[model samples]
Target chain A: MQPTSFENMFKDAFENFEAEVNPQIWVQVQQQIPTTAVTPQASVTFSGVKTLLIAGVTAIAAITAAVVYKSEPKLNTLVESKDNPVDNKVEKTVAPVQSIEKVLPELIKENETQKVQPAPAPASTTVLKLPETTNESSANNDNQASEPLNTVTNQTKIKESEPVVEVINQDDKHENNLSSIQNTEAEKTKETEEIKDFNWGRISNTFTPNADGKNDVFKIHLPDANYFKATILNINGKILHEWEGENGFWDGKDAGGYDLPKGMYVYYIIATDTNGNTHKTKGSISILK
Target chain B: MDEQQLVTNCLKGDKTAQKQFYEMFARKMMGVCLRYSNDLATAEDYLQESFIKVFGKLSQYQFKGSLEGWVKRIVVNVVLDELRKNRILFDSNAEVTDVLQTTDDVVSNMEAKQLLQIIQRLPTGYRTVFNLYAIEGYQHNEIANMLQISESTSKSQYQKAKIQIQKTLKAQTII
Candidate 1:
């Protein structure tokens, strides 16, 4: 017989515990939190090819619409730059070549002192040339987006003969802004991708909700395991309990809070992550109440 | 060396600051991990995973509470998570009572290591409730919320765990 119960023994033993932990544990932890890999989790959020395929198909449709609706000045620059042969076939396909010819700089100066010289004579000519370039760029703005930026540089060099290239560079700035918005969206997707599968699998199995604080709650632990539902069934295949969402912590009770009979029960989980990928896991758990 | 400064530096990608911050809490957190685990190896795993999570979610910590308390909470959660993964519950179905002896001595004259050993030998369910309620000073209802069980269940598990631990200590004649 014991005068003191185990609770007193344990509390006294553990209340201020300061045991020597193995140094190797720190090494393992450091590997998971490498300072450099800490940028954003979105890159790894969506796993498998299905999410990528969907994102890709959507991006393709967007590009096609951009090709049809955007302006033609970028394509004119493409026609001018000897560097991109890819745009030649694109030039034929879009066939906005007629506008390109109309907007083409006739008597474009080889180098008109490389500056406006603040003289109205050059300014008037530049004003005349600038509008044509603006019209074509607005027409093919979408295609201009995918075209190598080198074309812009080539335009600056080609049309430096006129003072209007400075105006086009301003347009290029807006395009740069447009592309930056696209980059941030891609970054957001990358962050979601970091919801990659967790290193800890099998985060749940049996739960004895008798609450000794041990196995009282079985949790299905996907990082973003949200918008999901879990169902528990007896051996006879009768559904006993169901929980909605990825916050799947199940106590050993049905929805009514009655103690489930002690036995093996099957659990079925269907979860959808933030990326809309659905995951399913099923298994049996033994409940001891 | 300041807590806020260390946290800020770690957030800024300073590896040295992270190591310093880790060393500050790792020992104490490891102690909490040990009580929830059956062995030093499992305790080490609990410690490792806990720190990794702490680092991962450090941004969410608002610094409104005690830093140690924040870290300790993460350690406790990780231990529970590991227990769930392993499903190491050993349910006690015995319908037995304690054979009380030596009523004058209300305490056990056992070494701390002996106490830990007996605790280590407890079934997962018992040890967990005992650790939470007895050692960690959580109310049974709070434990219920943490573990997703009813208050009655928490109370019962804690009581059973006490009985089991007392039985082990008595069998060893430490009380």
Candidate 2:
């Protein structure tokens, strides 16, 4: 046969032909060859992962702090006062330190020189209660009757840190108990006083809401009215504002918007002392704008 | 399944697809190995080695051309590789027969099975060159490169294989 005929026949016969393949051949192939499953490469760097974790942690901490600030906003009230002019006015008008009991402390300081005791122990927070007197009738009352106040300093620490503090407003029943224990429990401690006499202390006769760091509030001086509910009503008896405490005072506002107009507003105080004694007294505060 | 899918499945280490892949090409690849090998056992060894290499290098095979063609090339390389390792052909340096110029009558005269038997009977040198140039259609230069021989040597071995096949056919009285 010619070489050309031979090559053609060879290609035709065997190109697609299959011989018997041993089944065991595949087993040998499988044993020798590794599986081609996916192999992971080292892709992510360590610092990249660390940055992600740090970012996540910072986000969580910020969210938690925001939640805390929102829930207990009063905790930031001190800090916010400096930034907010409106809040500055509000604070001057209603800084808790201006207790209705503390009269013009500068005048009290001046009076103390003449009234100093021979003990020379200095002016103190010790006193029988001052008589209750509102700013309207304050002209009739002796504004300088009491000695200078020596606040058992930081007494407000007992509850809210106000210079004038009524930690827990009690009735007259607790008054005797309070006086007997006053030296032992009331000092380095905040406690109540008597409800026997309905008296007024040095009342600030004018509430100048000028935010001038002066008398921007009406200090209603119902000193014996522990456990009291008091409302400031208009001349029409329209209740403008209401406040209560063992001894509480009010901001010159209606508790919401602008300050009350410069005029007389009623201060109606109904006091229930620890002794269950209830006293109702109506007075007025003149807002001198 | 298409050749590309079959290769992909095999690459994924799916044992069933691997088995199926073997099933699809095993017989044909064995035919190629058998021509290059001395016996059924040796041919089976080459078949296994070829398949292992086929799976190992599957990822390197870009699926642009025929997948079967790619696999067939791997099987052929495995045969040549085994021959080179044993080195029986180079050791013998057997004489080249004067059968290069003969007609194709002898190879054509035999049955396909008989032709395969006679081809396997040729010496390793002649047999591999014949399988590459004749059945596999590789040029003499390619065969020379594959067998690590000169182009003349590849031609000589192929001619000698033809003479051996012709003699076997004459004895069997096929031509």
Two-chain DockQ for each candidate model: 0.26, 0.24
RMSD of each predicted structure? 16.0, 49.2
Provide the global lDDT of candidate 2 against the true structure.
0.57
How high is the lDDT of residue A233 in model 1? 69
Q: Summarize candidate 1's per-residue lDDT along B73-102 as a digit string, tens digits.
A: 889998887666656443434443544443
Model 2 residue A112 CA deviation in Å: 73
DockQ for candidate 1, please give it: 0.26
Which digits, one per residue and each the tens of the lDDT, describe model 2 over residues A208-243? 878897876665555664566667766654456666
Q: Kindly report the fnat of each predicted structure, to 2 decimals.
A: 0.55, 0.71
When only chain A is evaluated, what TM-score does every model earn?
0.30, 0.30
**Candidate 1 — which residues are off by over 4 angstroms?**
A1-12, A34-289, B88-111
Model 2's CAPRI class is acceptable
Q: What i-RMS does every model get?
A: 8.4, 31.9
